[model samples]
Target: MAQLGNIENLIAARELLTSSLEKSKHLASAIDKTGRKLEEINQRLPSLEAAIKTLASKCSLSEIGRHIDPTVGPAAAVLNVFDAVHMLEESLSADPCSNLFRYLSIVKQLEEALKFLTDNCGLVIRWLEDAVRFLEGNAVVDDDRYLLNLNKCLRILEELRVTEEHSLLSGGCLCAAYGKLESEFRRILMENSFPLPMASSSVSVGEQACIASLPFPVPVIQKLQAIIEKLTTSNRLEKCISMYVEVRSLNARATLQALDLDYREISLSEFDSVQSVEGYIDQWCKHLEFAVKHVFELEYKLCENVFEKVGSDVWMGCFAKVTVQSGLHDFIKFGNTITKGKKDAIKLLKLLDIFAALNKLRLDFNRLFGGKACVEIQTRTRDLIKKVVNGASEIFWELSVQVELQRQSAPPSDGSVPRLLSFVTDYCNLLLHDNYRPILAQVLEIHRSWDHAKFEEELLSHEVHDIIKAIELNLETWAKTYEDTTLSYLFLMNNHWYLYKNLKGTKLGDLMGDSWLQGHEQYMEYYATLYLRESWGKLPAMLSEEGLILFPGGRAIDHDLVKKRLEVFMDAFDGMYKKQCSWAVSDKSLRGKACQLVVQIIVPAYQKFLQTYMPWVQQEASPSRNTKYSAERLKNMVCSLFQPKLGMYGSNTCTNMMGNINNAAINQLSSTPAAA
Candidate 1:
């Protein structure tokens, strides 16, 4: 009986164990299915979350919070349901079945929430559109309508902040509620409606500065030539080239902005009611044009001096306002908001560079070989340069008309507005290279052995050659695509400058010496001391080493390197003075007291400049102390002969008149202002 019972128990126990193993397999399958479903839900969350953000962005908080439903607002209702469902699910999720049940419920809830935001809350977008439309059409200058309306929309978000049952939802509610407010704030800021006031309040500081608003307007154009000396490394070349292009672009943009505005109206009184500087942007541009241009020019000139290119855009936005000059009649002021983003604006800027180069080319050519060659070349080159200029100038009118006509007309393509700028730039490059190539070749030929090496290095370097080839290959794509004809323009003028320096720095002054020195006493007054003026009245530095040797001047006393033939000259004029003929009148003060030789020549030579510019000297004393004391003592001794304020280097060309004042002012400020 016991054996029978054991066998029966073993069989029953085995069957029970098998049944338990089957149940376990079925449960594992169910769990795997649940995990797959959860995985799908997880994947759906990102898409649904993105949709929520999109909808939220479309609507204002008021639209989301202001529920038309009589029971509760959608935001409030969604919050309540999500919290209640979530809390109950969390509290009951103790076993596997409970966890699965809660997870399924949460997934359903999330789907519903995403649906509400996407489908039902499109009204939010409509509401936002209405708000934007209302503001755009009815925006008034100096009025707070935009701000007040924005704030009203923001206040409605308070509904989203209050939690019906869960305090935890309160923070999230507030974040969701004010999200539109934050978006609107950002939008307003971007539009410059309520400008975030800067902490320093130094916007007006640079408004009075002046700079050339030309893309390639180099205040110190001389410095840029040094970089081409010996570029051995490709990286350095790339860096410098990029810097050069960027600086060139910036200068051109600044200059173009300064030139673009019609300064017919606007004045100092405009700033009073202007809460957003953008409202009175014209005025700001006018005021800051000075400083902006100065900053632009200064940076560029510094880069030029450093023989590097500068393309720093770090402070571009911050100093955007700096480029607008408020108090200018001649130039257009674009307060510092620069626009290099647009391809058209950039094209226009390049045209300006070409224009500036042409002008400089013309001037330098005229100055270098003034009498015959300049006149002859001017006749040839002037027409070509003029055509390019005219073509480029037409772009502004063409682009404006294109934009205006686009609303009614077909969107222009190859032969339309897009390529109109291209036509202009192309023509400019053609004119520059075609007729100007000879000039550039001549310029290259004129340079010494040292210069040939430099030109070869810059133009024929392996990297630059590759760059040039690449640029040529893609030339058709650029609106400004043409051969680098500006090199002709630059090279011609560069040669002219070399010749000009040679001509002006040599015995060319000797020709005029006999006829030019009659009015010498006028300029000689500044040079009674060693202020470095020539006998005919000119700054000693203005003369070349060759010319300085011909006429010894004051202020600079560095001895020339002894020539190899000094012994021959020494033997020739060993006793030429004949000291017995002229008795020495020993007067201690005469060396400094008598009129300086440079003053005599320069004063008379620049009678034209002096006549117009002499009266504007601000400081009565000499910039150098020794000059000042000597001037004062001389003024006392020969008060009748010496004019108090007038002197050489007192006046400058209109093209760059203010730089002189600024340089001296900066010097004084650095040296004396602090002490004072």
Candidate 2:
């Protein structure tokens, strides 16, 4: 049984081996067939890739065609690309301006076609370029059918650009569109732009707030921005910008005109006097401030809003052109006119006002005209500042010249402060006001810095010192006019006292320092002392006891000599009282002090002389005739000195009384026996 099972197993094994051999044979045949197919495919791969690239290029054309006509099949569209371009050129050649949107659509289509040609037709373009180079005698290239077709397409595009009628479809159409847009931009700006509410003298906060807001409505700005974007895209933005500058510049000028600042028509001849020029200067300051603060500021904001999409350079340039054309040049020119006009002392203050206005607005100038396009405006503004500074300096120094020219030969007989001194003090006071001190100081500093030694110190003190010195010299010159030594002293005293009192605690005083006050006080005191010594110093010596008593006779006084001395003393006192009573002491305290000094010096000497001599005179027949004034009466007379002389009504009474006293003294002296 084992043997028989072994035989069967061997037969099974044989059948299995047969089945495996057949399967292996089939696998070998399939592998051989697949390897042959792969070899065939590998040999055709290059041509297949070329066909795919050609298909892609055609698909690109189909994509463009789909954008134009959706019903066309891809193959038909690719075949009709040149025909479609030619049809678009013909459609665009008609009045493209009739329908701007339609015109823009055609332009966009051309642009798309141009992009497709540039991207996919590089080889064809290179061939054409070489052909052109060949035509230009640079090289030669063999032509083919493919090159010819592409050349036809390129020629259609070139016709759209070059043909007189169709050129409008390309750059000319867009230019016309932008030109219309520019007109629309102008209309929009003009209609929307209204003059800001202007204050005649100053800009109120409300008006400033209004000016700070956008000049145009949001819709208008958006419209302008849209037009600007179109122009920018078409590379024709300069026309739009120029139109904007022109319109806004006229608007700015109109705004100034509304403020009554017709600067261009203003002539130097109109300002015939300092007063007339002063009125204009005030207007100039107000108008300039308004122009800078409101008009130019509005223009700057308008530029920023309209050209926001454009660069800062574009906005800044536009703003600068508007500012220049908006009468800023004429405004500064008017200021220059004033500076170049006749130099007057009062012009100094007006020029200083202009300087201050410009100085205050300097930052605004730099902000508005900061670009290179507005360099001339900036330069003119700076030059105006320099002119103002120099003009102010010239006028200031002329104070001294005016003083030197004041060659008055007679001082005021009232012995009060001189008119020149008063004017000078008042002028200096104005110059040293808080509003004008720093300005004048800066003017003086700049002037001194240019011509004088190199020093960086405060110049107001030196300037004030020079002016004071000139005034002092002038006072000395006038003081010499007084033939009365006493009156001259009194004149000096009054003026020096006035200077000290006027400038004691003011800005001028601060500049003059404490030494100035002390020096003037000393001058007043010195003048007072000299006035006393010259007027009444000899009265006491006239009645001196040394002359009354003979040297060899001990205690033996001459009665006749004593009486003669008394008569001479009375005559001298009467003359001095009559003369000095007319002179004025304007200040109450100064008058009292002067009266007291005269009393202290003259009264005691007169009283003591009377006390010593009246005894000898009483022995005469009638002492009453000799003693005309008692000590009490003499003190009263001394107290009455230095009071302003009576007016016309009181003068008659004083003159009659003085005449009666003189007649009584003369009768009594004549009636008395001759001294022996």
Candidate 3:
């Protein structure tokens, strides 16, 4: 009996191996066949160029502009476009990653060129027909050459449509390809939608701005960009609606899972099944990945389509649209959420997927980690993951055994994600503050990889340094003066806002730090400290008043120099976007109100507040600078000034999303870095 059992087990193992291998082989074969078919299709596409040349040669050459050669100039442009469309089709037929995101950038240019030609194709052909009829009658010599070029264009159009039909059908498959693939798939889709990343990049920033030198008029670029803005707004609205639906669905599912409906105590059967909870995890992973694929795919397509319609001019267009009171409002909303719990979301998603994979593996095999086939892999994977997650119960579960005193009356925070988010946001706003204009310039220089040393030499002046000093001083005062327990939140908000405002105006790759927007979320929990529970004052008066803001306890800050520097800096920033970037601002047709909000608000309210109020508070120390005192304190200032507290709070109040991000990030840096 023992011998028979051993033999049976060996046979079962062999059968499993054989089945896995066969499936792999079948997939491999299918992939290869698809690749060959795609290659065959691509080989047949460029033949249209030959047809274009054939037809063009049949017509007499133009005396004006050269005759259309299917492969060069506009004809070449047409030929290249058709050729590209064909190749993109072939590539998608094989795999989305075959050429990666390469063809995406060209797709927009091709579409626009094709549409213009397609619309005029019949007209060009009709004109040629008329010219040919005149030739039979030996008519006017004036229009012959013009007719010849139009005839060649019509031929190029005829050849283009054949490929166009093939491309549209082939490109549709890319939706599925992208929905399934990872790695550059979304970016590729965006490239297809908007091909402006290239042209806009050519516009050198600072004094030598190439954007001003475009052969196309500035208004043309602006107009093109506006159309794209509408496209993007529509796309974003649709995506937001879709995302809300997904979030709502996910929330509903979670509610169902947490029903515990017999609410008295937990049921043993339902609880017992959770001992092997990986099964539920695995199920969620499958569904969630599917959902992400769809969501990301949709977002990519939406953005891409917008870009294509707008060209490189989209950012300029975005600059205009993003400034409307409503646009700025929505941006702030997203900025707030991103600063809240992006990290926690990323962590939980990965954890869920891994646990799900582990569960599915265990069910498939009686013992995965302990077995000869899986032992080494499972052990290695577990150790690596354990190190990364570091005490998983703290991250994943609240009910697990713990020594630390958990908050007493608060409902399990998993359910109070918003409040928990508040804690996280609060800490950030109190910690991370940024120097916007300087940071923006530095990041942009980094992005352009221009003469960094020279750029800094030219960009940073004594005035800029003074502005930095003044901003830093007041910012430090804000960080130091407040006795509020939730002071850290103020830091987080400013930092997030400053980063977005400054950097968003510049191109990517200009900043020294990673664009946290790319992959790893800025961890909200890092900012999550129990604020109200801890009775810490916002900033010590010692640090706020006497302590130099710049090198607070570290170096000397010339208080006089700081004031003048800041004034010059603020004036420069005021003009930077004055005539260059605004459109909606009835004030100036410059650009970027995002940066304006931070600079204008931060400079006056916070930067100059200490400059103004601190002197009034300390009557003996009052001397003269250009700074004016607006009351000894800001206590009744809001009431004295514009609108009194309209919200529930008698003092100024924020409606969560109505709060700030730039201040939050600034708070993060100030509280921690100097403390070190």
Ranking by TM-score: 2, 3, 1
Q: Which regions in candidate 2 have their CA more than 4 angstroms from the true location?
A: 1-176, 199-211, 215-219, 263-265, 272-276, 394-402, 405-410, 444-453, 484-487, 522-676
Write one digit per residue (lDDT tens) for candidate 1, span 1-676.
Answer: 1222333443343343322324434433443453344345445545544543554557554443332121122322333333332333333233322233233333333333333333322333333334444434544345444435433333332322233222224354222222322232233222321111222334443333332333233422322332222221212344344444443445434543443344324433343211222223434333333332343344333333434323233223212222222222122212111111122322233334434444444443343323341243345445444433443333332433333332232211111112222222222232224243333333333332323434442321232223222322222233123133321222222222222222232232232232333322222332233222211122322322342233466433222221212222222212211211121111112322333332343333334332322233223253232122232342233222222122321222221321222232112111111010
- Candidate order by lDDT, decreasing, is 2, 3, 1
| TM-scores for every predicted model | 0.18, 0.59, 0.20
Per residue, candidate 3 scores C-alpha lDDT tens digits across 1-676 of 1222333443344333322324434433443453344345335435643543454446443421232221123333333333333333343444434443333322333344344335433333443444344343443365565445445555555655444333335354333333323223333322333211112423321112111111223443333234334324324333322332333233323322332212212222332222123233333334323222332223323323334454534422322222221121222222122222212212333343443333344432232123343343345445433422332212322211110111222221111111222333332222122422333333334433533333443342332233223333333344343344233333433333333333332322133235543211242222222221231121111123333355746554556554544344434433432421211111111113323333333334444445543454344354434334232332232122211123211211122322322333222222111010
Q: Please, what's the RMSD in Å of model 3?
A: 36.2
How far is 60's C-alpha from truth in model 2 (Å)? 32
Error of 1 at 63 (Å): 52
Q: Tell me the deviation in Å of residue 270 in model 2.
A: 3.7
Which regions in candidate 1 have their CA more than 4 angstroms from the true location?
1-645, 648-658, 661-676
Candidate no. 1 TM-score:
0.18
Better of 1 and 2 by lDDT: 2
Q: How many clashes (backbone N, Cα, C below 3 Å) per candidate? A: 44, 0, 72
